[model samples]
Target: MSNDQAEPETRPCGLTPKGLERQKRILDAARDVFIEQGYDNASINDIMCRAGGSLSTLYRLFGNKLGLFEAMMTQTSNRVFSAFEAVECAIKRQETPEQALKRYGHLMLERVLSPEAVGLYRLVAMDCSSERERIQSLFYEQGPKRINDKLGAYLQSQVEQGNMRIRDTEMAAYQFMEMVKGNFQLRSLMGIEISEAERELAVEQAVELFLYGATCR
Candidate 1:
């Protein structure tokens, strides 16, 4: 074999278990760093320092700071919408609509009201750079839109099962989410933790209101 036949360099994508763990550390640190310092003020060096990795490694894995930020956001979005993955299973298991919705609403609120989510939302909203639209678009595509699609599918399934009457599942899906959220989530962004009892009441009321609209008249 000719010496020019050089060995293929191992690409440093965090696909393996070890690589995935390393990527997780970087993402976790990046999340905190970005939250502490807005995107404009945030730096790759700071993320690398917190993540205990070299800048070259970060660059090799993610094209730039923006790419890394997107990756971090995607990870967070995946986590936030993870509970929805079980919706189909729960429905198949014959769980009551209220039971399924209560669990989903609780998880959704928990994620939406979390400090990190609030911080991320603020970061995206405050960002006015050229890449702002790209970032916001990716944020929604990877996060909210994904959750909405899954929820819409679940609602459509219920409608077919003779349990509800919904003209537009998509509209109803967002309506339920909005009704459950309301101003409480906005207050959460301002660092106000509404009482647990209050949140429960809101969720219960939202679910009841939604059911009333969905049930056959």
Candidate 2:
């Protein structure tokens, strides 16, 4: 293989001077192209033209359209997960499991209701048939799996503290998440309208149902 065809050697963590600027341009262009053209319709030439850069720059930076897509998926997922982690951190530092859980639920609802998340979810669902594994990887890495793991850690902590009765914290965490997200996700997937008032009401009710249980006191 020619030197140009060989894989790029790793550079420093920071991008080289020209690389940084071109990378930003490519990302911005890619986002517009993807949004405008959707998944299958967009082309590398179109993206290159939008970015005003040669095809080589696109290849060197992202490999191809799917690489660019994976980058976009990672970026969007990271933002949501960062929000999740912040809530988890706050919850972990709390005095009680109930408080931690409530805070986490609230943050989760806020994120799910956000436009960025809604758009991303819709996009993933739409592309699932054609890009099954890629979409699944994105969802698994940044969605329910991570959330359940964090919740399980919290539940285990509670168990260790003798604050709750639980045979399996992982199961408990998964159940809690299912209770919390089940309705909203279903509605969102169906394109049903979820007003702000309804979202707040649903979140509060779900949290209450999970912690207090449905059995009469």
Candidate 3:
């Protein structure tokens, strides 16, 4: 093959099932390494050691450590946001907005405050170097931005159905998310234990407060 030609293995759509599996393995290993070692201390070699893949393959697939990190963030965000898919379906089922928001709030609290997610958030927080700005931006775009957009779409649907009166669904989505998170997310990231009852109460209160402002009044 010519140097100018793209390699089939490196092309995203060209990857076979085995190649896709290997890619997943590498991403999983990267996630573990990043969480354990932080961004600056993590090495491509360490990830390759855990993933059991050749360096050339890893380089070909992700280009560099930053690329691998971006891909991992994207993958993780996809998994996190997938849980909210039920929100869309809830609309189809004609569930009340309260029911939908409560379900969404609970799921968001659980997923966003998970150990892995908290560790990743700390990993990003600890890095403040100029070179890591891209990593930070990628994290926001892949994680928070995507999350807000998903919930914003759900809120937009509610507004269309006249169940809510939000003029800006995006801002409403962000506010509702913050309400659900409350101080519990901060406590989780600080290694403080948050009881299940506390989480449930937070979600219930968030939904109530959100509806008071958002519902047709």
What shift in Å separates residue 42 of candidate 1 from its native position after superposition? 1.0
Provide the TM-score for each candidate, comma-separated.
0.86, 0.79, 0.89
Candidate 2 TM-score to native:
0.79
The candidate maximizing lDDT is: 3
Model 3: lDDT to the true structure:
0.84
Flag clash pairs in model 1. none
Q: What is the C-alpha RMSD of each candidate to the true structure, in Å?
A: 6.0, 3.8, 4.3
List, residue by residue over 1-217, the lDDT tens digit for candidate 3: 3221224356354788999999999999999999899888888888889999787787788866777888999898887667877877887898888898888888888889988788888889888655488988988897777778878998999889887899899999999999889888679877899999998999998888888755667
Task: Give residue 5's error in model 3 in angstroms.
Answer: 21
Model 2 segments more than 4 A misplaced: 1-14, 128-130, 189-191
TM-score of 3: 0.89
Q: lDDT by residue for model 1 over 3-75, one digit each (tens)?
A: 1112223446337787787888899988888778877777777787889977666666665777788899889
* Worst ten in a row by lDDT for model 2: 2-11
Model 2 residue-pair collision total: 0
How do the candidates rank by lDDT, highest first? 3, 1, 2
State in Å the error of residue 135, model 1: 1.3
Give a tens-digit lDDT track for model 2, residues 1-217.
5322334344235678888888877777776676566666667788778888787666677766677777766666677666666545754476576677777777777776566666666666666346657766776667767767877887787778878888998898888776667678767767787777776666677777877888998
